[model samples]
Every structure is written in structure tokens, then in C-alpha cells.
Target: MKNIQFFFLVLNVLIITSCKGSGIPIDTETDINIEISTGSTVNIKIWNFRIDKDTTLLNFPKTLLGTYHFIKNKVNDFTAFNSKGEKLNIKTIGNKFVIYGSGDLNSITYNVNCSDKTSINLVSSGVIVDKDLIVLNNNILFGDFIGENRNYKVEIKKGTNFNNISNQQVYHKNDSIDIIRFRDYKQMINSPIIYSRISTNDTFFIGSTKFVLSVHSPNSMVKASLLSTILKPVTSAIINKIGFVFKDNYNLTFIYDEGLNEKVYQKIALEHPNSSVYHFFSTPSFINKRDSINYYQDLQQMVAHELFHVFTPINFRDNFDDCFYNDTLKMSPHLWLYEGFVEYYSLKILLDAGIIDKDYFFSKLAEKIYNYSKYVKMGYKISLAEASENIYDKSNLNIFYDRAAVLCFLMDIEVAELSQGKYSLYSVIKQIYKQNNKFNKDSLFFKMNSIAPGIDNFANKYIISDKYPDLSFYLSKAGLSYTMIHKEFGYYFPIKIIAYNSKTQTITIEFQENISPFVKNKQIEITEINNYKVSSYSFSFLYRRYYNQEIAFEIKYIEKGVLQSATIKPILVNVPKIPYYPNIFINRNMNFSQKRIYEKLFEK
Candidate 1:
């Protein structure tokens, strides 16, 4: 089973606009020359700087691959020179450099010594250089400066025999060098580059939207074709559910780490306009062991979350500044919409595609509520909008983003029920985007209300109000009952069966909570039940063989990497052992109105 615990560091992009200075030749294109050496040192040179009336602060990112890996001062020799070769005095503030005292800006040069900083084998978004490969993102390579109408180009001496790959437009200038060009600065920085000696890469199409998976891993079974096969349905689900597809090809660069770093723990998946980079924890060695996508359910969900950004706040944000984070502290107030809507759909698409059952779906939503109360217990109180604006200073709102995701889930069903299945939150969003893609963040709820009718009140109560929501109160509207069941008797099962593999004759099981106190939570195979040898009976018979038994029984499973037999004894306790998510289910008897709404909730 893939680890559900992973971090998604969101480093957004912005297009900065500055007024052009008088008589200055506004550069039509910005050219950068980069040099990469075999041992150390990654050098970058900015060719020209067309000054603007306002300040043009050149900045570099301090963090990237992971939380703690600092890429500070990787470019130590930063210096600017005018056309007359005169040195310009510059004042530094944090990571940004204020460019001042310059005639016609001639060139800026800097050599990067990446080995000097604090990566310490962490899988960060920053640059990584080693014997085998060099991974780079524009956040570390280039400086953020003025933009608009200025084309971007990069000339680099990439090295011999190293397979060069990127999401941007790449053209070869022989075996030793390559060039990449973008329409603007935003496009250029959004593209990531990977140079490796050997890799497994392939291309597949989902409804004419080409996807290329370029993988660099030491594991033999981590094939691009196999990954493409595993992720195809996930890709298709997002495309079909949203009713939109990318017209151009998109890149999925998959890179792996074998060192003693925490790369496997990072769970890194950074999104760009035309591509994304997925840094998997561990060796990515599960494909040969189990090829089913259900085995990697969290991966499936996380991939969907990243892909949904293409539609939400990413493409739909009003202006340039709204889309990009000009600084670390400045964040959009509509982050709740971005994270909540995207996360809920990640689960919805899977359920819609039958990849997961409703039991698992409701359980996940319940888990979110259970987790949020922990924060509430600690005296944390803030509305969704307030939490977003104060994300950095106060508690991180994204950490408890489920508070918002639950809101989106409620909004989704309300919209569906209100429209009598004529519309949903997803459809209304797309509909709004169809009319206008540039809706500002401040007016997001306004558009949602205009299209859905009742969302204005819904937003007022759940989003703007800091009152802790009674999820059961909302679930009741759809003919659903939410209850917290205490410890009873007799049903102490060790595994949660999510899916059955008929071909392999194995049941995909998840250990959610309290079943296995000693073992870690994961989906492992139940190879044998009692003495029946699970493969002998149908999927349903596992119940009679285990659930109804009052006596002791023996079951075999992989215990500490070995198949071992263990005896299971039933326990009946009046006291609850640990906190668990409340149970949610549809009521058998409901009023006609609620029954109709529930039917629309699960409408085919």
C-alpha cells in the first residue's frame, strides 16, 4: 500500500508587469545562457535587462524539493554590469536583489554551487546535482523579473550522452547542446528540466490529449508503459468528469531516488501549465509486485488533485497577480475554493469511475471531520476565508483544508439537489468558466451564487462564518443519517476489503484503524482465511468464513514480510478504544422530497 501521508508544497507562479522607462529599448526577448559542468557548478547569465519605471527586484527561491532543504545563495557570485562595463551597486533584501545605479543594462552573471547548501539528501524542489543525474526547476535556475510581451529563450551546453528532457519547447543544436524557448517568463519557469543517463519513457493518448511519462528509476519494473497503464483511467476520469481536455500534449516527468534521503517521504507532485513532476517516495518498486491501480489508491487520488488545478484557481484566477505568489506570505483568499473543490473531486472522480466504493468515500469524509475537531479542541477557530488570508501567520489552513473540502462536498450535493440533477458544483464551475474564465477571487462566491441560486447563503454559513459545522445537519438534507457508533460486541475484523482482484484471486484490504495495533496501516493481501484458502471461495463467502464465527479461527497473512498464521479472538468492550470517523449511510425510509434528492445525489 502507498503511504497516504505526504506533503504537497505549493509554489505558484505570477507574471509581474512594470511600466517601461523612456527611451529604453524594451527588450522584445530575454535570452539566458546556462552552463552545466560534470563535477559541480551550474552557471546562469541573463543577457539583457530593459529597465522599467518601477522597481525590478530579481529574486531566487529559498525552498523547493522539500520543507527543510535550503537552496539559499546557490548563486554566490551575483553581479550586474552596464553596457560600459561599469559595476552597479545593489542592495539585498532577503532573497530579492534591488537592481539600481545602471546605465543601459548589459548583462548579469552568476555561478551556482548547489553542493554548498542544506539539502542533506532531502527531496526538495530545488536543484539536485550528483553523479547519476541533475534535477532542476526554474525556481532555482532563473531570477524572477519584469514580464509581458517579452519572449524567453535559453541556450545551454547540456552535456554528452545525457538524455535531456523538459516540458518546454526544446530543439537540438547537435548532441552536446540544446535550446528551449517559451512565449513568456511564466511559460519558461513553469517548465522543469531533467538530465539523466538512462530512463524508461513512453507516450500515450487519452482522447487525443497526449501524455508522456519520462521515468528515471533503478527499479526494473518501473516501466513507463506500465505506469501509463496504471494511470490511464485516473487521467480519463478527470477529463471526462470536467468535460474538458488539453489541446496540446502534457508531460509527466517521473523521477526516483535510491539514496538515503527522505525523497520517498516527500510525496512531491508539482504542477505546471503543460506538465508536472512526480517524485515518489521509496523505490517505486511496486509495479512488478502488484500492477493494480487500487494498490496505489493514494497515488491515484493525489494525481487527480494535482491535475484538477489546471481548471480551478490556476486557469480560472482573474489576473496575473492572483495566479502567482509574488512573495511567500501573500496568498489568495480563495485558496479554500482551490483546495476544497480539487480535493473533493479527487475522491468523486474515483467513486464515479467505480475505483472506490461509497463506504470508503464516506469514511474519508468522516475522517476529515474527525481530524478537524482536533484543531477545534486546541482552541483554533477561524472561518475558511480568514484561515486562508492568515495561512502563514496563524495555523496553516491547508493542513486542515478538509474543513474546506467538507464544505465543497456539501456544496456539490446542494447544487445537485437544488437543480434536480440539472447541475452540480462541478458543472456550475465549468459553466461559469465557459462564460468567463477570468473571474476575480473576490467575486468567486458571487458567480457561484448567481449560477447555483442558493450558494450565497451556503457560503455565508460555512465559508465566511467561523462556526463549526454540523456535517450531520447537512447530510440529513440528502436523506442520509450520520451516527457515531460506540464499541459493541463480536465484530473485530483486522482488514477493510476495498476491492477484489478476480484475476489474481486476492482481496485488496485496508487497515484503517484499531484492527492491527502492531502493524502499520496499509493495504495488504489476505492470502488465506481459516483453512479455506481465500481463492477457493467467491468474494462474498469470506463473510460466512470469518464474520459469523463465535469460536477462534486461524488466518494466514504476510507477517513481517513472511506468510504467517495468526489466531483471531473476538473482543466485546463497552468502552471505545480509539476515536474513529462517524458512519454515514442513506436512510431506508425518507420523505418523498429527500428520497428524490438522494436519488439525484447518486444519479447515473
Candidate 2:
């Protein structure tokens, strides 16, 4: 899972950075040059400062690799050099710098600054390269400074041969490493990092954009193959659906981690228009691993969610400032449009492709509804737009996704009804992308109004206002109805089955929350439910289908080095089923117009 706390910290830093001048230009000549020969160090040269100043501050990042590591210990032997290659004087007052030299500082080199001597290390908002691979970032070579007409050139003295992110061969005319130049701090965007590996490679194009997607999953060939198969088509779908193109090579690196769910880092270059790079850290199960395929069920959805972000906040840049601190704690109110809509499409696309059935889609929707209902029941009423602005501050931040998705569900239904089955939310978004590729939130209502007359009004009520929406009305229009019931919903199993072995049809009990004192946390195996052997594939279906039934849990385990068997008759308990979302098969009957809307919803 993503470390939410760390994400918040990084968000705070970005908010501070945005408060400063973003677009100011410092006219300096000659492109910046970077030379990396070892994993533990980087050499950077600032070509020229166009303006003359008494003291220039070269800001070194205090944090390392987002918020996970600190640079205080990671960076050391920080030295500066002049145009004559002489060591210039420098002093670290605090985390920032107070430099005394004003000459043409040709270059500066520092240790890579990582405690972990792994082959691949993350540092300074980017990845570090070593003997195994070479992943580079601009932070190591360049600080946040105003430099005009400044391009960059990176030369790998040794290690692995590499290709540009665009899958184009890195042309070295006497080792050609061309760095595209841009003005302003925000425009630089952690300028694309270059990497190379010694292994043989292949190139694949995602739509018109060239991609050099490399996988370093040594443990799981299944995962590497899955990535190879899914990435291209998924990329194509996002590109075609959103109507965006890449200007330069988009580099992607997929590495295997033991227990890490896939986390993505998408870097878009303002200098190199439409150019971006992505790094995915995925946890792949080993061969013969049970539940391995089951884990991959939502993998495509995960990938789709991140890829959609490329079109929204990354490509369709957020108009508002990303401040989540006190006083100025604000963000783009269209987060619902970004996270919620992206999440909705993540599953919607899967359903459209026939990868999952309508039943599965409804189940996913129900899950989101159930989650959002918790907030509603607590009387935490906030408009979607307000929730978006204070996203990081809220304890129940996920409502940005859950509640927003529910609103989108209603909005899509509304649009279809308005167009008489001619237009849906999908079509509306495509239109918006065509008009404003990088959308401005302030102008969203204006652009959306051009597509449909009442869209702005819908936004006013559902997004901009604090009025809790009448979800039942939307459901009634969609041939469905649901009652928020308070009932006994929990069926006691005594054991929480965390990991399932698909091959053996056995579930290892991770913990036991016992209703009686008969059970405790131990190494136990649950092989059957209601006297029937259950496979990992059928676990979810059976559990939900027989949720209310009094079932027997067949168990087997080792106790004091002896195999044992027991049947656990779990005590049933009642749980709150507040703010229930209507399922796909509505209990309420549908009228002719509602029926037409329902049919159109699943139309391919």
C-alpha cells in the first residue's frame, strides 16, 4: 500500500515550492552537463548564470526520494568547482546553501548519498543508478535555479548501454546526450532522468508515442510477461480515449518488490512538451504461488488509474495551487474530476472490454457506496468541490474517490437520459479533452456547458454546493432503487483468512477475532466453508452469497507438531448496513425511459 503519511509530507513541500515564483527565467548560456560513473556519486556542472549576483544559492533537496529518506545523511562531501576546474568555496548554513563563489561554476560533484547500497536506489525525487543499472535524475545535477536557454547533456562514462525514454537510440555524436532547455522552475519538472542497462532490449510504441518499458522482475517471469502483454494495449486505450499525444520518448521502468503493491511515479516535462516517464514498483508472486493470478485481477485497473492521471493532473495540469497546509490549505476543486472520474473509468473500461461482467461492476460500485456511506452517516457533509480543496486535511480523504464515483455514476446516467441515449459521461469527457487538453478548473463549467445545457447546473448542485444529493432519485432514473437498512450483516467465521493457496484450496488464517474465547491467533488452515471445499477463485462469490447463512468452517492445522482438524461454528453478529447503495438488479420496477437508459449504460 502507498504510505499516505509520506505522501502528505511531499505534498506540503510541493505547496511551498508553488508559492515561490514558478515561471521566472534566469538567462544563462550553455546547457547543463552531468556525468555519472558510479552508483554512489553524481557530477553536475552549471554552464553560466546570465545575471551577476554577489552570492548564488545552490539549493540541495533536504528530503530524499520523496518523503521516505532524508538527504541530511545521504549527501556528503558537497563541493563546488569554478570555470577553471578549481574547487570553489562552499558552506552549508542549514539544509540550504550559502555559496560565496560567483564565477562560471563549471561543475559540482557529490556522493549519491544512500545508506542502502542496493543496485537501484531512489534519491532526490528520482532514481539512482549503479553497476546493475543507471537511473538518473536532474536533482542530482541541477538545483532549483532560474537559468535561461539552458539545455542538459548527461554522459554515462561506464556501466550499461542505454536508450532514450522514447525508445530511440541515444545518439552520441561524440556521446550525444541532448538536454532540451526550458524557462521557469515549474517548467523544468524534475527534467527526465536517463538510464541504461547492459541487457538486451526491445522497443514498443504506445499509440504514436515511443516507449522503452523495461522490466527488472527477476523473481516472477509471470509478472514480467503480464506487464509486456498489458502495457501496450492499456496505453493505447488511454491515449485514444483521452486524445492526447506524447512529444518525446516516454520511459517506463518496472521493478519487483517483495510486498509492495504497484506504486507509480509519473514525470511530465514542461520543457519537452508531451514528454513523460513512469516508474512502477510492483509486487509479483513467485511461480506456483497461490492467489498469484487472483492478485492480478485488479492489476489492469490499477494501471488504468495511474495512466488516467497522466491525462488529468499531469497532462491536463491542475489550475489551482496544491497547498494543503494551514491558512492556505487549498487544492484544485476538480479532484473529483481527476481521482473520482479516473477511478470510475478504470473499472468502466474493464467492463466495456468484457474483461469483467456487469455483476462485478455493480459489486465494485456497491463497495464504493458502502465506503462513502460511512461519511454520510457521520453527518460530515461537504460539497465534492470543498472535499477536493481540503483533501489532505480530511480524515476520511477516500470520499474524494468513493463519493465522487457515486456522483459520476449519477452524472453518466443523467447525461445519457438528457441525450436520449446519445451521449454519456465518457463522451462528455472526450469532448472536454478535445477542447482543453490541460483543463483549467475555473473554466470547466463553461466548457462543459457548451456540451450539455444543464451540465453547469448539475455541477452547481452536485459539486459546488453542500447539498447532500438524493442518490435514490438518480437510481430511480437508472431502473434501480435501494433502501439504507440497519440489519445484522456479519457472519462469524472466527478466522480472518488473509492468504489463500489456490493450488491446494486452503486458506491460512492471518488472525482470529473471536466472538467466543474458543479461538485465538494461531497457524490454522481453513480448507472448507459450510462443509464444501473452497478454492481461492470462488472465495469471494461464496462468501458474499452465503454471508447471512450459519456456516461451518472446516479447518486443519499443526498444533505442537501434530496435524489436527476441527469444525468452527462461528457466532453471527449484526453490523450496521447504513446508506446502502442499490445493486444492479433493482427491486423497484423500471419505466420505459428508465429501461432505455439502463440498456444504454452497458452498450459497447
Candidate 3:
């Protein structure tokens, strides 16, 4: 979910009065007015508010205390009208609006409209009246404004049903809907509500928190069910280990196309059974085909990846402020700890859960190894820290997820080898959680580094440093080998090729490799290499470094007609041999111990 910002404004006026009970003259009487506006086409719901004012003067909030920015003034398009139907020009100075003189303000009203049409972004609209007075039931989503646990009376213009409303305890009386309570403001913001006719709805009871799944389409039902199922076991595992659970009460909503297929949802369900998934399919001619197996696999992988978030980083962490959502300053150094470590566990969990077979798991691991090899080959290799900091950006998203996954695989194997199969990446994460009071990035790294002595150096060399580390050595340690192949072709020219430099009158014959017997006596002239046009003279210069086998060129010389031409086939040569990892299991080693581990992890 994206971060959102909220704004608040306060108007103040001063008046003098005599205190009857406490004697003496006291500046007691003060009048203040407040208004909030929303510029959204979608109905805006503000279920929490906090405001306090006294007789002496109106004291407004200087800032949304826990929020990172100053947004009081940006809550614009407001007007203060008097009882006589006259407009009152108001100027905002800092947090308070100066209302000239002291007078009893009768009432306050506001009209909040949606200003932007670029899809409903929650934070850009929706303002909780008297935000400071509102008690935060959960964590803050975007800015610092928290939701109050108290009931709120919401009056919407007639004829519009509330769509994507969070915390389902809202009741309708007369023309107003009374919002009863909220689980957490922060969680509410993370779960955005989009209004559409078709949606996937699922309900689950997790202790006191009622988990609701609302998606945009019926096809999302399978995915939602799968997410719910996966999370249930993981959640049960955590509960069994510890006496508590995180994210106690929450709604997991997903918005996607309206016409998505059921098979897509089923694949997602197969992948993630613990998460509440939702989607809206927008197309009608949705077809199921065999080629879609890869697509299903990818979707299931994504579901498992997301559902794992519930326990791994969400519940256990080092620093809260340095979180990716709130503290941008501290996020860079901890990206690897959060994304990389989490990625490692996601794959492990899938393997352990028995969703994938042992051979398939190793094959996936091999693919990671291969991809990491390519990333190393590239000049600009990124460390976990660099990848984390730039992960959200389009340029780094792929590397962050892929490279981190590969590193996790290597590190998992390293841990497994070091502990002689007693400890794995799971142990490392569990240890991190146990050591840190709060689940955060910094603490996780600290714990991980403590267990693995050279972890920092490993991170620096392979992750942070520009120098590429040879992965072949590490991979070979796990009983793997690397290979590279090269091939060459021979050409023969009968006639001596001449290069006439029109600018500098030079003559040269391009170098032709070992001559073939058939064309030895025929006059041949090289005109191009790999489709790149070159003069007969420049062919010698172009042939030296052009090692690729897939080379194409045209040979032009007088034959049957004026300018006869023949196309040359590109030479086919083998490059480096990457490990062939199978995606499915047909023939692979599977023993009792491996089967036991897989069953214990997945419980399937």
C-alpha cells in the first residue's frame, strides 16, 4: 500500500471574562470554528476525530505529532460563512486561522469532494474530523494521524451506499450511519477500499479479530481462500510457539480486474492458503490453457511471498521508526535484512510446506544460482543494501527480489552446512525474532551477523562492493560445476580481395580462416559480419573480435546477373553451460529424511 497524508486546521478568537468561582478577572471566553473538506468523487468516510478547545483561547495542534510532514495548510478549499449568509474571508497562519474578533460561533459545516480522478488513493482524500482527539486503535498508515476507538456518527448525502468501508460495524439510523469502532487506523490505511459491484468476500475468525477478505472479482475467491489457508497454519504455528498473535483484527482487500478466471484464483489458492485474496476481473473471454501453467506458478509464488510477510518481518523486527513506511533515513542500510531475508524464508517455507517437491526446490535454487551468476557477470552488481534502497524504483525492483532470493538460497545452504543440518535460514530468523523486542530490520541484521561471523564481510564483498565475486566456487562447494563452450568456422577465398580506400588509396585482403576445399579456387569477397555492412578491406578488422556463431552476411559478386548475391548462414556455437534445473519432478532423489522435513514444514 502507498503512503497517504492528512491535513487539519483550527480557527481561534480571544475574549475576556470574569471568573465567578475563582475570583479576579480571567481571560476565559474564546470562540473557535473548524472545517474539513474532501475533493473526491468517491464517498469519503471519516470514522475518527479529536478536537479540544477551552474558554481562554483555541489551541490547535502544531503538527500531526507522529507524522513526518506539515500538512495543516494543504487541507484547502474551505470557507467560514456567518448566520447572515455572508462570506467570511479567512487566512491560515501556521496551525491556527485568525478569526479577527471574539464572538460565539454557532455551527461549522464542510463539503469534502474528490479532487483527483487518478483512481481512488485513500490518503489523498478522507479527513477524520478532530484527528488529534481521535484515539488510534491501530498503527498509522501513511501520516501520523491515528484512528480513535470511539464511535463516530457519519452523515453522507442520501442515495449512495458506502463502498470499501473498513471496520464493518457501521449502522444506519435515519439518514446517517454511525461508525462504531476500528481495529487499527494504520492497518485500515494499508487496506484500501475500492467500490465495485463484483468482489470476492471471505470471512475468518482469528481470535478476536475477524479477518475479512474483499476482492474485486469472483475469480479472486480461490486466491483468497488459499491465502486464508496458508496463513492459518503459519499463524497457528506462531500461536503455538508464542502466546500471542499480531495484526489481531484486520480486513485484507484486493482490487484487480473484474473478469479474472477461477483457475487463476485456484493456482493462487494452491500457492497461498493463509492470506485473504481478492480481485476484480475486467475481461469476459477468459480462457484456461495448458501454457498458463507458468502463469499459475508465478501467481502462487507471489501469494506465498506475500502471506509470509505476516510472521517474518511484520511481527518481528529491530527498529520501528526505520521501517520502510515511516523512516526513509534508516531504510537503506536494512533493505537486505528485510527483503533478502524474507525472500529466503518465502522459498524455504514453500519447500518445507511440501507445496513443491525436493527436486523442484533444488531446481528453483539452481535457477537462482544461474541468475545470480548473470547478475555477477554484469558490471553493476548490487549489494543487499543498495538493492533494498532502490527496490521500489523500476530499475532495481528485479535485482532486489531476484538477487536477494539467490543470496538467500546460498546463505541458507551455508547455514545448513555450518550447523550440520541442525540450523537453517529458519533458525536465523527465529533467533532474530527472539532477540529483538520489536520486529524491525536493524535488529534482524544484528542477530544474523552475530550468528554468522563473516556476514558483514560477505555482505560488503558480494552485496555492497562493485567487485564481482565468483559464485562458481560457492556453487561447486555444494557439488555443482560450471562449463563454457566455444566453436569456430573456416572460410576460403580463391581471388585476392582488395580494399580501395577512396580517401587514402590503400589495398588489403581480409584475413580468411583455414580455407575449405570446395571454394578454394573461387574468388570470394566478405561484405558483412553479423548483418553489419563492411567494405571488403574492413572485413579483416571486423573478423578478429566477432566470436559469436550467429553471424549473417551477404556475399555480392557478379554471377548469373549483374549483381548476384548469396546469404551466409551464421555459425552455431555453444556458450557457457548453465545448470539444467527441472521445474517438475519425474526422476530425482527423495529420501525419508527429506520427505519428513518437507511434510513437517508444509504439513500436507
- Number of the top lDDT candidate: 1
Per-model C-alpha RMSD: 9.3, 9.3, 15.8
Global local distance difference test of model 3: 0.40
Kindly give the number of clashing pairs for every candidate.
8, 7, 51
lDDT of 3 by residue, 333-359 (tens): 454545565565665666655555565
Q: Each candidate's lDDT (Cα)?
A: 0.62, 0.53, 0.40
Candidate 2 structure quality by residue, lDDT tens digits, 1-604:
1211111000001111121245554433433334443333444334433324545675644432111123342445667667787877887754445556754565555544422312223423444544434444444434544332333333333322444433333445333333233333333344444443433234578677776566544334433345657666666666667666777766555543332221222111121233333333333322222234444555556666666766666656445431111233356788777778878877787777666678788877877777777777888778888877666464535776698888888888888888787778878777877666666678887777777667778889989987667877887787875544444465545445567664465666644555332446755665654444544333443233234556554455545556566765545655642223445456447788898888888656
Rank the candidate models, highest TM-score first: 1, 2, 3
Against the true structure, candidate 2 has what lDDT?
Answer: 0.53
Off by over 4 Å in 3: 1-180, 183-188, 194-196, 204-211, 218-250, 258-286, 289-296, 322-332, 359-374, 390-393, 439-444, 464-469, 480-604
lDDT rank, highest first?
A: 1, 2, 3
Q: What is the TM-score of each candidate against the true structure?
A: 0.74, 0.66, 0.53
